[model samples]
Each structure stands twice: as structure tokens, then as C-alpha cells.
Target chain A: MNCEEISELVYDYLNERLDADCAVSFTVHMDGCAECREQVSDLQHTWTGLADLPQEEPSSELKARFYSMLESQQVAAKPRPLATWFQNLAVFPLIPQGLAAGVLLFAGILIGAQIESGENVDELRREVRSLSQRVTLSLLQQDSVSERLRGVRFSYQSAVYDEEVIIALIDAVGYDKSVNVRLAAIDALKPYLSQQPVLNSMVTFLGKERSPLVQVSLIDALFGTNGGETLETLRVMSNDAQVIDSVREHVRTLLEESV
Target chain B: MNVTDVFSDNELMLRVRDGDNVRLGMLFERHHKKLFNFFLHTAGKRQVAEDLVQEVFVRMLKYKHTYRGESGFGPWMYRMARNVRSDQFRKRGNAPFDSANVETVELADERPAPAELLETDQSIGLLRTALAQLPIEKRELLIMARFELLKQDEIASLLDCSVATVKVRIHRAIKELSRIYHQITCEVRA
Candidate 1:
């Protein structure tokens, strides 16, 4: 209740952070002391001002500028002749609607009895399968190995029904010819690292992986493993200092639980 | 909105995940002002605050794919914000605070200043200055607690600290605030 103790309690009292006994004592002290009461009021008022401070709003121009910046940065990363090939294959995303339109046209023609030559009918089927072949062939024919790997990745994340998808992801980890593509594939597959084989392979590689980028991906994969053994590896690798903090924080929580 | 409402933050995040730019637009409309102010209060500079908020959203976009659906979306977004903020301090090469500066609150003021008494409102400058002088960790916790209004457990998760540690830090932070407030008032009067 004296000036020093009461003043110290002023903040905790305002925040409701003091223990019950200390709160009771602080309340009693404030009840009789004019100076202490003023201190409490000032602290409360200061808190109110701090609370009322306004947020910064980005103006319209800034938002547009930032968006343009992002788009330009993405544009800058556009791959070489590979980007041109994508320009060709990119239209494939709209194929469902195109196919639907074609189906509607075919149904109308058939219902109206607008008969075509039998050769024309066979040629249409041939054309459709031919288009499918070219699409698959174009993916295989990409000049950059990474572009083909991306096609594999596309199949991996999107076509889960295919057994080859996850297998491609794992195979990319150790086999992809391009480092960057391998890095992307490994990072992307981190979502499924809990899969026992993925965990087993990542840990096996993490033990002696010299490439920091691959080690980084393995660290991300290790998170799904959930235990001290993984933490032990990260703690030992703390010498890298680069990824140490990222590793250490997880390790810190692990070490805390163990102790 | 209720967390599920069309206007809710979670809905906006879901929209962002689904590639709905208009919903992301609404997310900016809803949170931009509030988040921007959080940095303004914490950094005490509009440009820095604006840059930090912009960087937060940029990082948000960069890491959008990593957002797992397990937690409430608000905490996840703010946790991202907290990381970006701490990363700013680290990049500036400021080391951690000395514990001595943290052990106790300084006492110098209880008397009201004329500027405050006349309007029945305290000078915001005092509080802002006081907050700026606090250690980055303490300032971060207090700004997040005061602005985002997260409870101790949520703050703990956002800071990646224990709940007890959050409680201790926040208690110390508020005490530091009161101390800084008093010091500012004394300096102004003197």
C-alpha cells in the first residue's frame, strides 16, 4: 500500500494481471491514497490512448502498385522457351467448357438429323485422340527437364487416384535432374510427409545431406514426424546457424517437454 | 461476421484459397485499417507501419499454400503477422533486451497534466512514446494484446511461447508501459 508497492501494482491492477491477494491489497491501498489513485487513473488513461491509436490504411494507388509489383515479379520468373510451351498447354485448363460446347453442338446436330459422312465421323474421333496424343507428347518433349518434372508434379498433386503421383514426388526427391525442380517437388510433397515411406526417406537423406536446400526441405518434412528423435537431428544441425533458429524453436519445445 | 458469415475473415481466407480476388479485396477492406494501425502504434511511424502491413500481406500471399485448415483462420493470419514483425527487428540487427531494463516499473508521475485535464483525455503522445521505448518483444506482445485483443493463450501461440511466459511478458510489458507513461509526463512538466 506504500507509494512504491502501490505504484508498481498500478499497471497489474489495470490489466487484471495481479494475483487475488495482491489485487485486494492494491485495491485497499488505492482506496485511501489520492496519489496512488491518480497513478492508476493515469495508467488506465495511457492504456486507452494506446488502444485508440489508428491503423494505417494503404491508399488505392499503393495497393495497385504492390499488385503490379507482384505480377511483374511473377512475370520475371517466366521460363524460357518453356514459357512458350506453357502458352500452348495453358489453354488446356478451359478444355472442359470447350468439350461441353462441342457435346452440345453434336447433340443438336444428331437430334436434328443433320447426317454427316461416315468418314467425317471417324475423322472426328481420330482428331480427338490425336489432340490428346499431342498434349501428352508436348509435355514429354519439353526442352527443360524441370518443365517435364512440373508436368509430373501437376499429375501428382492433382491426380491423387494415380499411384504414380506420390511415387513421382518421392522419385523427384532423389532422381530429378534439375535441382530447382527437385526442390519444388520436395517442398510440395511436404503436405504428405506423414506417409511412412516419405518420412523414412527424408530422415535417411537428412542424416548426411550436404545440400542446404535439400536439408531445408527435409527439416520441413520432419515436422510431421512429431517426436524427440527429429528434434535431436535438428539440434545437432544447429551449427548451420542459417536454419538453426527455425530448427531450434521446434527443438526448444521438444527439449522442454523432455526435461 | 460470425466466423462463417460471408463477410467474416475466415470466409475471406477461404475465398483467397479458392482464388476469389473479390473476397480477398473484402479481406483487405476489413483488416487493412486495423492491421495498419497495429504497426503504426507499435512502430510509431506511418511509413514503417504501412510498409510492414504491406509486407505482411505480401508474405501472406507468398505462403498462402502453407495455411493448414486445423486452426481458426484469424489466429493463423495474425501469427503470420507476428512473425513478419519480429523478422523486421531481427533484420535491423537489434539484439535482445537487457533483463535489468525489465525487472521493475519506474515511478515518477501520478499528477495529471493540464493538456489531459482540459480535455478529460490523456495526451496520446505520452503513451506512443512510452510504447516505442519498450523492448521489441515486450512492445510486440503489448501491441498485439492491445490491438488484436487476443487472450494470453492465443498470444502464446502467436509468439510461440508458453502461456505462462506470455502472462509474465505481458504483466511486465504493462508495468513497463505505466512506468514509461509516468516518465513522459514528468519530462513534459519539467
Candidate 2:
């Protein structure tokens, strides 16, 4: 096969799907042709590099949502269309619907009063932020991995970087069972890395984080701290036998660049 | 042994089609993450990717009766995923790039420091941006061929093209990807 023909079959050859005779012919061409060999090598390297890009696991909420959806689908699949229709009609009646509408109207009026005159918008926003942080903290403590991922996301969206949120995030990075949630925690902590506590939490987590993805993210986040402390932490991590080789190499590079 | 252990994906899917709804969970466990990654890489958004994964399985359930049990389940699932994604675009009347995570590209650009890993990640990010810049068809083809580990013939089957055509398209897609990746990286370096 000429280079052009080999190029067409290169990926197939690299993927090892070519038939035995074609594969031998391809190999014979590679033996005689340097340019084709280089082309195949470059393609192989690119393919390998693409594979090395970390595999991102979806957050646990996806599984939960899938199961819930499957359950509902199965329920809907059951032969009860007429029964369900009647049940819905019987349940959604006039008097209770009116009562529900009245309650909603009353709540709307109350909310309008609060928005208009109860407090300044900034204060109300502050209250909302605080409430969200509290909820985030509670969610972070939940056993459900998806809930914890949601909590980490909430922390990212939070306007307030309260110590509690930071601590919860730190704990998550250090101890979350799911790598996805911990990775989310690493992302959620990015904005707060400027704060001493957050930086300290990241540095502390660096020592304990076992996942290569989390370690790389933490390394990336802390690489900008611009101090001996960050370098020192990286230096220690670089030499740690437990740290992955790729991470250690990166840390060493960070050390050199920082110097 | 468990039924999942005893059956291939195609076989399991056949069971799923034949009123054995529980077998779908086995398939979900087998392929959902792969599907999620495919959508994540394609869409560049976790939430959207997750939703799309869910949507693919839901479509699989809805369309289970149509499985001919001929092609491998991976290719079939990906075909359904592509349909789900396109159907979404049609329903929303928005282009695929409308929801591209521009913030991620910006985040990658923000880190200007010179560490090997950082540079590596930045390169990956640049590649991602380049992939995003390609027309959606080229990007999807490259993603399935490279990342999803689908064979050329399988992809051709999925795309309804000849295997030879899929090979050249994938090669051209990689060439385009390399060009865009280097162009973006050079701009970043400059």
C-alpha cells in the first residue's frame, strides 16, 4: 500500500481491526517507508494522548435520576391508563384547588410585601445566600453521592464563601467516597483559593487526595498561590511515592517554573 | 449466575425488549458512563451531558421494540444518543454550540503559568476548544472514532456510510482537529 492507502487504513491498523494479510502488507510498507512510519507513530501518539485525558464520571445524581426515571417509566408502562386518569380527575377537585390557589395568593402577597418593604434587596439576598450555604452544608453531609455533588455545585454558585462551606468542601475533597463529588469539590473550591483558609484546605487535601484527577486539579489551583508554601507543598508531593508519576512530574515542573 | 452475567449486551437488550424490563438496568450499568462521557465530551456541560445520558436510555426504553438485534449495542446506543442530541436541537431550535461551555475555555486560558501538567491540561483544553469549533458532524465523528473506541465499520454502520468513507472522514477529521488544536495553541502561546 502506498502512503495514501496506508493513511486511510492507518487508524484501522492501529486499532488492530485489519485482516491478517492486509496487516502484513501494512507492516511491510512501514518497514520500508520512514514517512509512513512517522505518520503512523504521530497518529498513535495523538490517539494515546486523547485516551489519557481523564475519564470524567458523571455525578451520582445521574444514576439516581435514571433509576427514578426507570421506575416512573415502568409505572407508566403498567396497564393503568384509565385508572390513572380517573385517579388524577378525582384527586384534582374544585374546593381543594380553590383552597390551594388562595394559599398561593396569600403567599404571593406576603412575598410581595417582603420584597417591597420588609428589607433591602441586598439584605434579602444576603439572607438567601446564608440559607443556601446552610443547605449546601447539610447536603454535603448527605450519604447520597449525587446530593453531595449537588452540594458542591451549590457551593460553587454560592455568593458567600463562608468558613463552613469551605470546611465542608475541604472535607469533601479529603473524604468523599465518590471521586466525582470530590472532583466537584475541587472545582467548587477554585474561586476561594485566594483565601488563606481555602488555600490551607487545598494544601491539606493535597496530602490526602488519592485520585490522580483530584491531585492534578489541586495542583493546578495551588500553582498560582505565589509563595514558598505552595512550592514546598508541591515539592513534598512530588517526592511522595504514593503520588502518581504523572502528577509528580507535573509538580516537579511547577517547582522548576516557580523557581 | 445473574442474567446480566450470562448475556451479551445484544442479548440483554433482547431480553429488555421481550418484557424483561429489569435487564435494562444491567445495560445501564454497562454503558451509561460511556454514554455520559460521550455526551460530556460532545456537549462540554455536565448537567446537559447527564440529561442527555438519561434521555438516551429513556429513548432506548421507548424504542426497545425497534432493536433488530443485528448491530452491536454500543453503536446502536450511540445512534440513539445522536438522535437524542439532534432531536433536542430541533426541539429547542438552537445550535449545538449554543450551549458550549465557553467558561471552560476561558478557565483554561486564565492559567498562564508554565508547568508541564498545566501546559498539558491547557493543551487538552485547547484541543477541546478546537473540537468545539469544528462543524458538529466532524466533531461527533472524531469523538466516536477516537474516544468512544468504536471501530470504523461500526461507526460506518452507525452513520450509514461505507467503512472506507468512514475511515477517510475520520482521518480528515483528525487532520482538521490537529490543525485547529495547533492553531489555538499557537495563538495562546503568542
Candidate 3:
């Protein structure tokens, strides 16, 4: 090793990363070269001096502030439950008894005759499905957690398994701030697990979800969809150290049962 | 082994990205002290260093999705810290190294007899003053390499340069630091 080579490998030598032959060569070169030896020694001293600089401990307020900010952000991200909106609406004055009965009677006669004729039954079903889809999509977008929960319930009940509704429910499963809504969305998606998009979304969301309740529900929902892939995902998740113990244990139990 | 010990920085960061954002507490616990010291050495004020450390963590959360685990979490995090420091300096409309904070020291006509400077507390103080006098980029390189114990390749990744470039810069940085340390030592002796 020449002086230039020593300059190039000096850091490596200092860090002890140079191999045995190169290290020996470096030592031999340094022994013979006073200039290289002084330079290396000076650099080494500077490096050591830097380590002597006192490490200042940050104030306790830093930790307190960080955790408080985290808590606030988590709280802000939570979606409000929709049930509150219904409770507010319940305080409104009731409709007049006679007027309510009259409207109900008129609607009953109109719907009764339509069903009796049965000519537009398929058209009516389509209309109802379209309306339900609209309602489900709208409710899912609401700010109230309960309303989103209703949307998830509406999604499955309407049997309106369109691309838009599936996407909405998939989003709820992945991004909903409320655990109840996410759990409900997972349940709504259970029957559709055989579908590629729904299955893929669930599998992807399963990896991203941190809540043990939601994770366990997702695992249950995905249990038999594509047994091989599901088992593999479960097995990987079962061993994941990031996963909470309860969820991992649940996964392990399921894997053992499958065995 | 403790449960938390089982979780690596990357794993904790990945969890943060995946909506287990509270896991960032663990990352913060592991890195905040070293990061605080890095900022203190670079920024030269305790308050400013604390603010920078806070900003880095906030940015980590904001940009959590961008963490791909391609590099170890240390390099990725220090990269963010560098940006936070740069942005702060930019916002303040000042250079990263404030000349006002650096005390001028005259270079000696000749090298002082190699006293055991590195061994004394007063010499350590002078060394710190020498460090503060270095160009900001070179000071940062030395801090990361020596204090933070970041490897050459890791520093390269953080600086978006190659390992060879990092090596050259580090060598030059240490040489500059040594020159300044000697100058300060002479100033003190005079």
C-alpha cells in the first residue's frame, strides 16, 4: 500500500473493516511512512475527541410533548359515530298522528296494488338496488362512525355487490377510524372473499391493520378464501414480531387447527 | 428478551407506516438522544436542537409511507434529520453555520508540540469550539461518522452520495477539524 492507497483505505483500517492482507499491508506502509502515520494518528485523535463531547439530555418536556401530540393526532383521526346524529334527530317533534297514518295508508295501497300486478317487479328490484347502492355509498362517506357502520350494514343487506360498493367497503376495512366499522366492513366482505379484488384488498389490509380485533376478524373472513395463500399469509403474520401476542397466538391456533 | 427488544427500528417504522403509529414512541425512545446530540452539535443551541429533533419525528410520521426499508432505519432517519435542519436554516434566511456563533482563532506559525490535548477536559472544550468553526457540511460529516457511529455507506446513503465520496469528505473533514483544533489550542496558549 502506497501513501495514496493508505489515504484511501485509512478510514477502513481505522474502522477495522480492511481484510487481513490489506490491514497488514496498511500497517507495513504506515510503519515505513512517517507522514501517513502522523496523518492517521491525528485523524484518530480527532475522532476520539469528538466522542468526548458531552451528550446533552433533552428536557423531559420533549417526551411529554411528543406523546401528547401523538395522542391528539390519534384522537383527531378518529371518525365520529353516526348514532349521535340519529339521537339529535330524535328530539324533533313527531309528525301529526292522522297525517302520518294517511300517508302510510296511501303508500301501502299503492305498493300493495303494484305487488299484486307484479308486472314491474324486476324493475322495482333494480330501482331498490340502485337506491340502496346510492344510500350505501353516501352513508359510507359520512363523518359519523355510526353512519359508516350503517353503510357497511346497508352494503351487505342491499346485495348490491357493485364495484363501487366493494371499493367503498374495502376502503372502510382499511382506513376507517372506528374499529366497529372496520369489523363490520370485514363481515360485509366475507361473502365476497371469493372475488379477486375483495380477496386481494382483504389480504393487503390484513397486513396493514394494527388492531388485533380487526386483524382477527380479517383472518376469520379470509380463512378459507384461497386456502394456500391465506395459510401462507397467516403463517407469516403468526411469526411477525410486530404483531401483538394475542393476534399471533390466534393465528398460530388457526394454523395448528388447519394442520 | 423483552418484547420491545424483539422489534427492530425498521419493523417499528414499518408499523408506524402501516397505521400502528403509536409504535413511533419506540423509535423515538431509541433514537431521540443521539439525534438530539447530533442536532445540538450542528445547530449549537439546546433549544434549537430540541425543536429540530421534534420536527424530524413529525416528518417521519408525515412521510412514514415513503419509508421502504431499502436502507436501515438509521440512515433513512438521518436523511430526514438533514432535511429538517436544512429547511430550518432556509426558513430562518441564514446559512447553516452562523459566523456570529463561531469564535475567530488565529492559526499558529508552527505546530504546537503534540501535547496530550485530546486527554484534557479543557482541550475537549477547545475541540468543540474547533468543531463549531468548521463548515456546516464537513462538521455534519464528522459528527455522523464519529459521534453517531454511522458507517461510510450509511452516511453516503444519507447524503445521497457514494461511499467513496463520503470517505473523501470524511477524511477532508477530519483534517480540517484537526487544523482548527490546533489553531484553537494555539489561541488558548497565547
**Which structure among the candidates has the greatest DockQ?**
3
Error (Å) of candidate 1 at residue B65 is: 1.5
- Superposed by TM-score, candidate 2 places the C-alpha of residue A211 at a distance from the truth, in angstroms, of 23
Question: How does model 2 score by TM-score?
Answer: 0.55
Off by over 4 Å in 2: A16-38, A80-259, B1-5, B98-119
What residue runs in model 3 are displaced by over 4 Å at the alpha carbon?
A83-259, B1-5, B103-119
- A1-259 in candidate 3: lDDT tens per residue? 7899999987777677899999999999989999999999988888788877776778777877776777677667655534554465466559687866786687678868877898469767865775687578768868899899889888976654575577678778888999999999888888878877678778878888899999999998898775666777898999999999999999999888877
Instruction: Indicate whether candidate 1 or candidate 3 has the larger TM-score.
Output: 3
- The parts of candidate 1 lying over 4 Å away from their true place are A1-42, A54-58, A66-259, B1-4, B86-122, B149-151, B162-165
Full-model lDDT, candidate 2: 0.76
> Positional deviation of B71 in candidate 1, in angstroms?
3.3
Deviation from native of the Cα of residue A200 in model 1, angstroms: 52
Task: Please identify which of the two predictions, 2 or 3, would achieve the higher TM-score against the true structure.
Answer: 3
lDDT of 2 by residue, B58-113 (tens): 88889999998897887888889988888876787866752254444222124565
Pitting candidate 1 against candidate 2, the one with the higher DockQ is 2
For model 1 the TM-score comes to: 0.46
- Going through the candidates in order, their DockQ values are 0.13, 0.18, 0.24
